[model samples]
Target: MTTESGAGARVNCVVDAEGRVALELPAPVAATRPHLLLRLRPKKGEPVTVSRTVPLEAVADGPARAVLEPLPALEEGRWDAFLLNGPDDTAPERLRPGLRDLRALVDGHLRDRPSPVAVRIPYVTKEGYLAVRAWLRTAHAEAGRIDVGDRSTTVTARLHGATFEDGAVVRLRMRGSDAPERDVRPVTDGDHLGFRFTVDHEDLAAGTAAEGGIWDVFVHPAAGAPPIRVARLLDDVADRKASFVHPAARAAGAVLRPYYTLDNDLSIRVATG
Candidate 1:
């Protein structure tokens, strides 16, 4: 098949219920050596990359098609997709997003997967490139419906890859501080295995002086299970810090607000009045 050399090419992506990814290139790629390259967005440390070749039959007259199976999991991060038309030495072409089909992901089909729940969401980046937000969690506390009250905030969350024991508790620990941690037992409903906990704004304000601080939230699923971070990752929203804002409550001359961090982990910020 013929291929395009321009960097302005685009890719249409469709993610199945089982986390399988299908990619369609704007133009046909080399049938012999077409590949999909996923490079994790760089940070302070070294970035990770994964590559998968396209099968012969998946390509046809129209756009070149390639499928990335769910197995051999990807690292948890935002990965940018590229189209490699030639050998490994070929310059990869950045792919713009087009016609993304992610209905299965919206239906929450992978939520019941086994331990180390793997989730991959394909989306268009702010730069208009095709990228994926991935997560691999051994134990996850997915923050669900939240109710903000005058004096307290109630959070209901679902536990995955871990079961709640009799002494299950949620911990609120101050970030970058030595302050003692506060623990509150969540009322677990056996029917759905979901739990809900309430955080008092006054209690959070009392934990810190006038300056106030940020408290990271965690869930202790059982007696021996390691603490799992409370986050919201089951949906399509890649970054929730700015998109998912919550109303702040005033108590003890302080403003208490719950918000999602840059990493999408749930945290409460207390600011002195």
Candidate 2:
């Protein structure tokens, strides 16, 4: 979970290791006996709200603080948290650190009831999107190193937290306008796994009118577990010192580069002459 606080007021919060939320606020705020409100709304569906007016003794030191534990644990989804002055208070002034850039409903009469006050703040999780995640008991696939060549591509990887037989079927999942999917049998060397894929330079070019030149690498473990993304786990390479540079691409008047996106999803950039 990500930690956020009120922008105008002195407040800080973090989700602890045990999944409990710890909030710290100014001593003055606690003296006033103002209520602490927590509102979580998923991107879709109904919202969850909780509130309390903690005592000053709850303050660890000079600053006042409190901890909130979800009764049954937060639901699985992208959740937005709001630390407000009152329980479900719609007053603009009562708004604290929350989502900003939300346009005020210009036509309030268009709704069944009054619209809630707008908060002009932006708060996000550590990954920039607050989400309740669920992890599987099975192992996860990790991408190791990629070997990019003029005619083919090779991927080195490992399965963390679980092991499988030598013949576990691995595949490369690609998503784009065309949405092409390919299968490859990875050769296992002890704990390390290796896969090779053929590439067509002309078909990967810009003039080919081929769908978006992007592929999302994915792997399916043999134990019938869900597929996982093949991402860049190795150290990022500098542009000038990329390990998989292809001189043939330059001679062919084309560019083929593989990299990880901002979200750490592995992708390849193929541009034709």
Candidate 3:
């Protein structure tokens, strides 16, 4: 079940070795034991599917609990972590290491080595409006939530329970990796979230392809609520179409780039939360 604490998110995950694990994220989540699953990049033309349930027994105990990869020992006592950048009464390392590790991993997974899918950057931010959520910046964590750890720390997400009306203009900047173009996707629904906004081809400059590039989008949250992963926008090069295949963007060809290029309607649509 998907639950929310402030902005802390509870979702489900399954890896090869582990069966299925329920995770409360925006917080640092590691295994209670060892032996876990690390998300793998699907081979050429292979679908990026993760339907396996990780066995708890495999990770019942050990020096390192795991995910898509084995994590280095965290001296603070944590084995793994995740974050959207929030502050904690605990040490800094406990709250935001996920962002640091993510940067390194994203760099390694550039266009040349990018997965067939795309993933939206977690732990979002706004420049000036209000500090809604944070990972490592303590000054900013006040408005959000936090989860501290011994070997590691877990922070909670700041849930605004915010909303936007239909036809609200929005913008999405890619957080990591590159694409031919950056496209902002705003999907509307009546579910807890109205629509989604994240990047794809339309968000980047023209003629750029999604092989090995990194991109970030800036939006004014006033445009709408934060976006969650839906489907990644696709790519069309030389009149041939191929989809962005990151596991996060497993579904093919629903929304492609340019909600409207050069329109400047969104004001980059990001607010400083």
Instruction: State the lDDT of candidate 2 residue by residue for 160-209, as single tens digits.
Output: 54455544565544554655555566667654434434444444453333
Clashing residue pairs in candidate 2 (N, C-alpha, C atoms within 3 angstroms): 100-121, 206-272
Report the CA-based lDDT of candidate 1 relative to the real structure: 0.79
Better of 1 and 2 by TM-score: 1
Order of candidates by TM-score, top first? 1, 2, 3
Error of 3 at 193 (Å): 1.4
Candidate 1 matches the true fold with a TM-score of 0.89
- Residue-pair clashes per prediction, in order, are 0, 2, 80
lDDT of 3: 0.24
Compute the lDDT for candidate 2: 0.43
- Winning candidate number (TM-score): 1
lDDT of each: 0.79, 0.43, 0.24
Which stretch of 10 consecutive residues in model 2 shows the poorest summed lDDT?
112-121
Residue 269, model 1: lDDT of 90
What would the per-residue lDDT of candidate 1 be over residues 27-75, giving only the tens digit for each residue? Answer: 7665566667788787768644454444423356667777878987778
